[model samples]
Target chain A: MAKVLMKGNEAIGAAAIKAGCKYFFGYPITPQNELPEYMARELPNIGGVFLQAESEVAAINMVYGAAGAGARVMTSSSSPGIALKQEGISYIAGAELPCVIVNIVRGGPGLGGIQPAQSDYYQATRGGGNGDYRHLVYAPATIQETVDLLMEAFDVAEQYRNPVMVIGDGMIGQMMEPVEFKEPKKRPIAPKTWSTDGTKGERKPNIINSLYIDPQELEDHVIRLENKYAEMKENETRYENYNVKDADVVVVAYGTTSRVVKNAIAKCEEEGIKIGLIRPITLWPFPDKAFEEITDRTKGILTVEMSTGQMIDDVKIAINGRKPVHFYGRTGGMVPIPDAIVEEIKKISGGVK
Target chain B: MLKDNRIRVITGHYGSGKTEFAVNYAVKLAGVNKKVAIVDLDVVNPYFRSREKEGFLSDLGIRVIGSSIKGASSDLPAISGEVLTPLQDETFEAVLDVGGDPIGARSLGRYHEYFQKGKYDMLFVINANRFETQTKEKTIAYLKNIEVQSRAKVTGLINNTHLLRSTTIEDVLRGQELCKEVSEELNVPIRYVSCIENVAKELPKDIEGEIFPIKMYMREDWMS
Candidate 1:
């Protein structure tokens, strides 16, 4: 297929359709509005369903309904909108339903602004919903990677029977890039026999519920969920290490912020600063193994983010104080520029030698 | 070789390269010692606005006008009174980079009175690769819609179809065909066929409109 210029939001919608997702439930929000709009226009043509629920809460519950019925389903929103869907996400996780939730994050603790941001790092990686549950969170940096992950996201969701969240900043939705829709490597997704599809009176009907009336039953269920997350951590943790084998400083970044970091690394290279990068593609798994790739010669790890300091905690936890972890960030819809990141790296490199 | 209009207003669907065309046109006018100024009336899109290139264009002796707020990160919909300077002053060759879609063009409507009282050309940029303006019917609909919203008729069409840094010669020719169809249907002249210098050179001389060789000014090197 020829490479076509696509906005990140619309490309994600197309990837969902290509992955055979038949139902979409979402509310309108800036940055991610184009996604639901695209689905509204295209899904009906393919004999699929596109429903713009009255609110994000209603939309996510609709996702719960569709996922329980064994349909490939999706919902997308921006920061605040995604916040509204958290409870439903937890419910879906408890029910062990397979679905895809896309969050084109904008700056906010609450209604912060409509610009590119990575402030929702905790909301995505740490389950904003209640109870002990986990889901795969893929933070893709480029539009091509977003497309590939989105296509495979459905498979991963079904394979694990958990909701998969694909989070990108607002720039990911706004930027235009040439992307080819290549097939992602397929995962071994078992049949949805666990779904609450009608049994046709010939077999036992499948039940989909999160409510555990018995205390021990609920504990058992929670443990089972933890084991599934453990399986994910073992099998799905992914990261990208750039020039980390030997470097004075290793910078950690993800999503749109990582692209800016790449630019800063190039500038540092030109200045003979020798900066490396560890880009975590999966925020939930945290890619702790990536920290091992950093050579012992590295002086420190600098975590860069669009938020004041969210993902830096993960970096510290991953490294476990192996090296001093420093943070450089901009918040409230402000994006960190390449020059600023270069300055931060220069400061870190200055102390090294 | 293009028309030397005093005020050139660029409008198009989102991602149709309207900002890119306006930036190239202003830079070209400045190259010939024309006193050029750019009014970025794009309030719809937060990223990739002509205002983002204010520093670069200002360094080249071209005045770049954006919102009333001087801060580049401010995403408010406010337009500056400074825009009136270029439109009112005949000595200044002005280029208005209006936003994408009719909603974006509504910002241009605020200056309808000034544009009505003067000689100006509103060029509807067409990118066949863009989903909204791919077909003749869709292009015509968007053109008429923009006119309704901006309260101004599109005087000419600019073929600016591209896939960022990956644009090929065939893409331009494919866009030329669509632009020609929309041009003949709406009776709007094809004013320019804009593309990167390499693809512009590959274009046949017989193609309609002057071939405008443009650099990838709006796109970053990493974006490719």
Candidate 2:
């Protein structure tokens, strides 16, 4: 189709529709309200369902219900609303239902603030909800990535019969950017192997649920989830590395903060400071092994975010504390400007006068 | 006592039930035959908000003002409301449901001059379980920062610390202690301690605030 200038949130909504998602349920929240509003307007035109649920809780459950019925289902929300949806997410994960969840994150410890924030990195990567489940997490830094990853999210979710999260921040959701919508990829027809559609002739009733009180059965289910996650890590790990050759300082970031770090790296390069970046495309199954390859060449790693050191813990763990890792960020709707990041890079590189 | 006609600024941590309190209190005050207006100044948090349910509040004869839902993409016109102009008129009581946290509360800075022209009481709600301010000292510091950012003194405290569907009397007691600490430290009165059930018998004698009971029913129509 024709390319259009779209906000990241709208791009995600459109991409979901193109990916055969016919059921969308969500509550309107800032930074990502456009997704639902767009879906509300467009879904009816295509004979799809769009529901402005009473709350995030109801919306996620509605998504669960739709996904259970073997429909391509999706939901989007900001951090606080996403927190409210965690219970449903856990249930979805337990049920092994295929669904897409988009978290256009904002600041939060509890209603932290509705500004662009990478505060939910740990929550997204480490399974925000509960139990021993992990979602296929795709972190998109640009508007184009938002569109592309959303389409990929559905494919990945179905392949594993698990929940997949398209994790972006307020910057991606709110900022206007020029984007070219590539022709929608042809998706496979819904697998008829295990869906709740009434049995026709030879098939039997299919049940999709997360409740398994049997210890051995639950253990078997957990093992199945683990194996799926292992397969995903082996086959689905993705990241972007920039200017790591002989670099003394490596900055690790993802989503919007990574864009700022990119600018900071350019500034440092101008000053003859060799600073590189490792931006994870998939936050869960985080590019830990990818980062480990460069630990020996880099002097230290700087973890940057829009929140106070939330994602730094992950970076530190990824490095296994082999190198000194420092963190700098602004909290509660305050974004870290490129200058601040550049300054931190200079400080870490010992180039500060 | 003179009729306190200042714009009441209600704020708290997330999931602290600030929106529920603000909505019920604003509607209750309006129900008592008072000219009441509520401006949803919360743009930060998303889930529990009075503005999202503007249609319901408007039915109760409460004038609801908020940021244009259309201009949500841009931070245009920081909380412009007709309610501020009528705050000086003792005939109307204005309540601004500021967003949670200091940054969310900072949007109120634009209305500082207008608030100064009339009486306004800024109330800070406290939930002891929320991060960053689970203790009294931390909560006081957060409130002070909010006070500095908005140029509005927190004149009262509301104890609303409750877990989702798991709130207990013990939680309320802990919240009460935090409330007392804030009241003494900030020299602000405890305006009300909110609870879903009536636990008036358990309240300490020295606790002076009125017990505000909240009844929240999930609408069946919305469910369908």
Candidate 3:
């Protein structure tokens, strides 16, 4: 394995290439411009297609077209741009296409700041598009983790016949760290008998569309997608627990915020505060099982996020009122410093409500 | 050795990698206990500015003077007072990581008199492998424009032609040839040919100019 210090955005781009993804379509957006720039400069040399489409709307549709044709295709954007592609994303999911989409997220309800924020958690995990479908969402905290997840993201997408989103805050996107692209796994996936390129006069033309105007037919499709999501919940959920074996406060977080929470947890441990961390590697399929590992000593659960408090829902739903859950966040481009999180931990421990 | 050239000043266009080069250069000097300090004058774009790297460099005992409001909500161009203080420390050599384009060099222009007053080598890092600086004449124009904007003459040329991890020995050699041509045409000495460590190890033994093997400071995290 070869390791190099690379930014998160760059590692994702390289991992996409390593996964044999030969087609890319994306519009330029901050914190993620590096990915497209890398693809633009590198793709041509390898005889791959890197298209800077007219707009984010067009880009996602192009990815949809490419993925539908059986090419491993991808696209990426920051908050605002990803917003524009919601319609296309919904269609892709409805059509059950296997593709990779990365949201190197920035702050937003609208065209927010360029800085990193995990404001897109609800949209990403809940599905941005209007649909009765869900995509496998991976929220990687480190550059290496991002690479490993991304290298397998394509295979996961294909395996489930659904889209795979690598959601990360701007920090995870822009920060520099060593990332190693390991040898490609012989990921077993169902062969594409559904690709439109085939049936060359041997069979009828293949069609890929998400529209099901009929209520009952659409309901059947929705049930089918729901079953797939349930299977994913049973099999694909992943998480990491640090020092939770004996702790009173088990803080839950994902992506960039988990790093800060871990640091905060260390400070509390030194003071004999007995705090721990549970990081969700996968956002969707939520990693709800992590909550079961909490102990009798676990007095409280705190969910930390870059946004005001999006992932807290998943944490609460998972904990199911078994323990009181707290939330600490930094929104609109502010990163919660370690000290701030430590304060939150103390407040929880001292029974400050 | 390249270390002899103290008070190094780097100025180039956006994406020319002046910040990355300056960071590695400062780290190298600090590693040798040379009392190194890096001054960040990039008030133009705050995102990739050298000041953002203060925490990383300061951990290594290298004093970094960057924007006071670095990574803050407000990205106003707030240059720190400590920026020029390092230049006064005789024991401390400094690296002035100037910003991109004429607009960016305005901050350097504020300290132009001070830089010219000291024993410094203003390096015009050639933006090789990029279209604007692909040719000698075009590269010369950029150098001249930056010099005029910053009001400082470039004492030397640094061939930093690259395409991240994709840079091969041939790319470095090709860049060296361009630097050679520009070196002769502009009458500026070719001080170093900067390449990442991996490719530098494979550089031809008989290459021209001093080869300065450097770490990738640019957003090369994506390069495999």
Best prediction by TM-score = 1
Off by over 4 Å in 2: A183-190, A295-297, B1-224
- Rank the candidate models, highest lDDT first: 1, 3, 2
Task: Give the least accurate 10-residue stretch of model 1 chain A, judged by summed lDDT.
Answer: A344-353
User: lDDT of candidate 2?
Assistant: 0.77
- Minimum summed lDDT over a 10-residue window in model 1 chain B is located at B109-118
Q: Taking the tens digit of each residue's C-alpha lDDT, what string does model 1 give over B43-141?
A: 887778999898899988999999998765567789998999999998999999998889999998888886753388899999988877879999999
* Runs of candidate 3 exceeding 4 Å displacement: A351-353, B1-7, B11-48, B51-95, B98-224
DockQ winner between candidates 1 and 3? 1
Quality of candidate 2's docking, in CAPRI categories? incorrect
Candidate with the larger lDDT of 1 and 2: 1
Worst-scoring 10-residue span by lDDT in model 3 chain B: B215-224
CA lDDT scores, all candidates in order: 0.90, 0.77, 0.81
Which candidate gets the maximum DockQ versus the true structure? 1
Task: Give the lDDT of residue B93 in candidate 1.
Answer: 92
Candidate 1 regions exceeding 4 Å error are A351-353, B30-37, B53-92, B106-118, B134-141, B144-151, B184-187, B197-207
Pairs that collide, model 2 = B6-B119
lDDT by residue for model 2 (A5-68), tens: 4556767877888888999999987778778877997899999999999999999999988888
Interface RMSD, all candidates in order, equals 2.4, 18.6, 8.2
Candidate 1, residue A117: how far the Cα is off, in Å? 1.1
lDDT of 1 by residue, A1-353 (tens): 86777889889988999999989999998878779988998999999999999999999999999999999999999999999999999999999999999999988888878888999999998878999999999999989999999999999999999999999999999898877788878689888778778888968988889999999999999999999999999999999999988899999999888888999888888778888899999999999998888878888899999998899999999899789999999988787889988888878778334
